[model samples]
Target: MSEQPVPVTTLLDDEAFLGTYQPDIWVFVQRSLIIGFLTAVVFGPLIGLPPEYWLPIMGFTTVFSAFIFDDYTSWLNHRADVWHLTSLRLIYENGNAPEQNAAVNLADIHATQRKLYKNLRLDLETGQSVLMKYLTNPRAIERDIDIARLALMGTIADEADIPTAEEANS
Candidate 1:
């Protein structure tokens, strides 16, 4: 329930660093550029544009637009989209307003399903599910969530409950 500054990495309302849930920002940027490149290759000539000139332009536009969109959404979700967890709760904000947030008590989490590419779907006791998608490190997030669960239940986590030191440091 107390705020902590994580230097260059994170800023949250009042949450200590349990863990974070975010995708690599570059991944979305790269995907957008790739889509633009493919579009230029497939559609540029049909629109009477030369591939050589069109490719870069299209790609640049795609990446730029993607960056803008991503930035805006990231900005919106800064409070929530990328979770900054604490011992007692997972706090997230997803909009321009102060009231726009979704905080889940660690105790309400019933189960979680994780997929490759860093997607985690958490089932809550309320029968609602929350999906934290495109995380850069799903397993680490899961580990921390598990730890939070134990902590919320008034249990202490042993070394075996967390990621190895090497993995966590990285």
Candidate 2:
């Protein structure tokens, strides 16, 4: 007889996993480009190098700026930060440390707002707000949060009770 593989379960197995969100890649690219360009423009001439060597100096400064600002600093700070949406709660994890994690019950979220271009603010009933930065399509995430919140509160209609597109048209 062939041996059967056992099913693996995790601590979160009881909750339905909805989505996982991380900082947008475009935020990194944009920051790197802006910082690199500004560093090259400002420091290239300040070095008082020969014209022939100025191009190489600028290139080096730009690369160094990108490495220092984006790769080393920003990436180290935000790379491990992630938000997970589940049926019961929203979980935030920072870095690889288990102690640096938090979860808020969906019922506790009073509202969600999209701030600037990519930031999401979650206002809790207790008057505390959590900010999620550099998310891609934060508007969609906001909508999803609203939907989940309403569903949890038993406000959404059943799918069977809703009319299909064709039925509505007819």
* C-alpha RMSD by candidate, in order: 7.7, 8.9
**Steric clashes per prediction:** 3, 0
**Position 142, candidate 1: lDDT:** 76
lDDT of 1 at 97: 52
Off by over 4 Å in 2: 1-14, 31-75, 158-170
lDDT of 1 by residue, 1-170 (tens): 33533323334576466665555555555556666777677778888876578867776768666675574365335333546678777766543553655688889998666764457788899999987765656777777787777767866667465545455558
Q: Per-prediction TM-score, please? A: 0.54, 0.61
Model 2 CA lDDT for position 67: 77
lDDT of 1 at 4: 39
Model 2's number of clashes is: 0
